[model samples]
Target: MEINFKGKRALVTGASKGIGRDLVIQLVKCGAEVVAVARSRELLENLKKEVPSIEIVPLDISDWKKTKEALNKQGPIDLLVNNAGLAILGPLTEVSEENVDELFSINVKSIINISQWMAKQLISRKAPGSIVNVSSQASMAGLENHSVYCATKGAVDAFTRAACTELGPHGIRINAVNPTVIMTAMGKIGWSDPKVAAPMMAKIPLKRFGEVHEVVDAILYLLSDKASMINGVCLPIDGGFTAT
Candidate 1:
């Protein structure tokens, strides 16, 4: 289907690179006025050169106090994509307190804080809106070294479900997209070793990693009115990896 978000206002976190950057560009292509947010001002400025129409918000979403202020300044939005996350991979036993704290602070806490703010804004304005949190397939099942990352994403999944219940009456739809091994720069380096990636790919029926745009397509679908009835669902763009 041809999706057009003409005249919509969107707030996208983690908008500097990877899937987040792709979303900002694609959302603009669909005609939405997107506020691209990330910690890197330099990268965001370069992104602006490519899609100058998008508004750039240069702030770290993991900073609780500043994040609240930054988001509040945005006023109101029709679409919110919570794509900012930190992935620190290690075994559960070997995980340090710092690793756990930093990961949760960025991945879990940020989602709740922003979603709460957006939900309130939507309710106050008496308007309907959609929220798509970029989670991971690791949340569905454990990976070899993604213990903490998995935990945070799993929390994200649970939060999305409960948030939808409370916000449903307020005309806010909250959902998550869990994608596996997307072919971003990090993905390539992380999975470049055949020994490390072979077993993971074997599990996926398609035997290939997802492209960035495919995940972006899912995010846009959830944000669009086309997914009106799809609420609180953690849709997996895993190439059937989770099927087995």
Candidate 2:
């Protein structure tokens, strides 16, 4: 059966660019009323010009009080994609405490704070919806210089599982999508060198890093009722790389 969300309202964080931006576009096409959240007001304004009907909320998700305020003002939404994240890679021993705090604030804490507010909204309204957290393959395996990012994402997946258990009875499902070497604009720059990408690609059965749409598609599935029975799972969209 085909997936559809014609009248659903979706709140997508990190929506200014990359997979988040593309996801917003796709959701709009699928007829969902999208509330796009990100820190880039210019980019969001541009996106609004393209999709005039979309709602835009530009705020840093790292600030707990402000993030909570923004979400509370958003009224109600049917789905949430926690895609905002940051990575400051270096050797584990050399990583700064500041970096660790920053990464955790955005990549980890943001999800919990936002989801908590969403949970209250859902529970109060007695509504049912889905939440998709955009995690990374780094969460599953160790990568050089990615120590902090990995830890944060790992924590995110753990929270997804635990949150699913508590929120499931409330009819709010939560899951995480772990992608590998995606081909977003930022990704292209990070993986631009064949020397850098070749080795990572070799580990994947598909022999290629993933494209943004592949991830977008996976997230859309999990967000839709098509994945109604799928909850509390950390789905690896890694081109079978994790199979190795």
Give the lowest summed-lDDT range of ten residues in model 1. Answer: 67-76
State in Å the error of residue 28, model 2. Answer: 0.9
Model 2: per-residue Cα lDDT over 13-48, one tens digit each: 999999999999999988899999999999999999
Question: TM-scores of the models, in the given order?
Answer: 0.98, 0.98
State the lDDT of candidate 1 residue by residue for 12-74, as single tens digits: 999999999999999999999999999999999999999999889999777889988988888
lDDT of candidates 1 onward, in order: 0.93, 0.93
Model 2, global lDDT: 0.93
C-alpha-based local distance difference test score of model 1? 0.93
**What residue runs in model 2 are displaced by over 4 Å at the alpha carbon?**
none
